[model samples]
Target: MAARQGRFGAQPPRSAAPGRRCVMVTANVDIPALKARHPLVNVIEASGVKLRGRGRVRQGVCPFHEESEGSFTAYGDSQRWYCFGCGLGGDVLDFVQQLEGFTLPEAIARLEGGHRPVPVAAPRPAGTRRPKSAALPPRDPALLTAAARFYA
Candidate 1:
């Protein structure tokens, strides 16, 4: 079984059988694609916080870290953030983590709207009983057969 922390700071449940656990983080997420999904105006309208600036990047106060200056910059192409003062940066997930006080897993889950690569239990081989005939001496065929019949 493999355990990983979820966005809410809880460890995700593991599969029944032990094996390699391949965790995919933003496997299908494209920063550019996500950025294009929502326009800057839409984001600005939806956000309670205000933003200022123009051109390719918008400037705002660092919500995740302490900052008196508007050091947080959001890139229009990537729809990500970078703080020169705190050196904190990343895509939407990182931004959410900082803004909402969410863990990595929690932020990812929120961005994804759910969990991905859902945990699945692997089938285990059933145990079988060996026949007594295989363990018995070859000369004692009758006895082995009788023992096998009795066991069966």
Candidate 2:
């Protein structure tokens, strides 16, 4: 009876303000499953790269750079790519990131068929680094004078 008291557990959630009902739905995304199901080859081809056979790897014109010949190689088993022209490589997420200049989350969303907003890098939080105009400590007067005289 206790287990059946609520949809999930015994306690009715306290945050509903007594009259409102709240529901929580979580998706435990299995990355490996997604990777296996959606091959990098498909994603690459969908993005307009024309792949050709090159032994175990598939070769295409380097999407990340301006190249006439095929220099981008995508491995079928690994679901990844590397560029001989630009020397860049990584997994599916990385390829999307490099190709579209989208942030990690944006790339993942695109790969999973989720709605993607404007593709731009996410802003990092401000922390240790100083601003460009941050004042520097006053230089030693003797050192400044010496440097000025040397430059003059």
Candidate 3:
């Protein structure tokens, strides 16, 4: 179906306010892809928070709250961040959400850096057979018997 047209004969995406363009995003967002594209340290530094230190983790003042001492930590390798002062910790999406006062979907949209929505797959039918897991290795009968005797 064609998208609903707004003023000036232009089509507006779902959940968008008047004169604002926003695409309707559904569930099943590729979180790994988003994190890979935007690293936690990079995002924090981009926001003008001066981080100090090297390696996987970096420390800086908590941007969520007022403080002079450094209490915010950003894990570059894991793409996550935490603030000890405010007791807030989470991934990049959580950072954007808290910082911008936006909902999860809005945070995702902002991090995506595009107005387009990620493609959503159709829902699977209930009762679909799941794949069998790998079988466990055989146990040593001799060792088991010895353990049982020792315990007894």
Candidate 4:
């Protein structure tokens, strides 16, 4: 029997089993170009993460989890983000994946198609004020020692 032809003279996928068929899908996308086009700062802002900083470093609340404190940090120079609170970190694609719950290919396609996630307005806890300086607040030695002991 002759195989059926698909669009562009491509042959239809063949069945591996008597009743089951296997299909292969491929995407031709420039990953570096995609990352260049979608920088971490823009992606973070698009996801409703309000960042505050003087230069390349910005801080905001972790969108992945609820917290009254801001533990999410984005480095504009490196085009990456890391949430100290949740320990999640990565580039723009990772950000999209985490924010939209998309797989690797899905995230890539979403970026290629210029489909950004809807911005979620995060509520600020009362009495929280934006710091005047860009520097992160110093960590408490006591807290650090306790954390070290717990982890150890």
| Clashes per model (N, Cα, C within 3 A) | 2, 0, 0, 0
Per-residue lDDT tens digits for candidate 2, residues 23-59, read 3311445667767766787777767677898556899
Residue pairs with backbone atoms closer than 3 Å in model 1 (clashes): 7-105, 7-106
TM-score of every model? 0.45, 0.54, 0.57, 0.61
Poorest lDDT segment (10 consecutive residues) of candidate 3 = 115-124
Leading candidate by lDDT? 4
- Return the top candidate by TM-score: 4
Residue 22 local lDDT, model 3: 61
Query: Per-residue lDDT tens digits of candidate 3, residues 1-152?
Result: 46787787768545666786565563667878887887777777766667899999899877678666889999887788899998999998888778778777788878776632322224334444323335677999998999999999
Candidate 1 lDDT tens digits, 86-129: 89887655555665676555555655564321222232233422
* CA-RMSD of model 3: 20.1
The Cα error of candidate 4 at residue 150, in Å, is 36
- CA displacement after TM-score superposition, residue 33 of candidate 3 (Å): 0.4
**Candidate 4 TM-score, C-alpha based:** 0.61
Q: Rate the local accuracy (lDDT) of all candidates.
A: 0.58, 0.69, 0.74, 0.77
lDDT for residue 82 in candidate 2, whole number 0-100: 93
- Candidate 2: segments with Cα more than 4 A from true spot: 1-28, 114-152
Residue-level lDDT tens digits of model 4 in 3-25: 77877786865555566443222
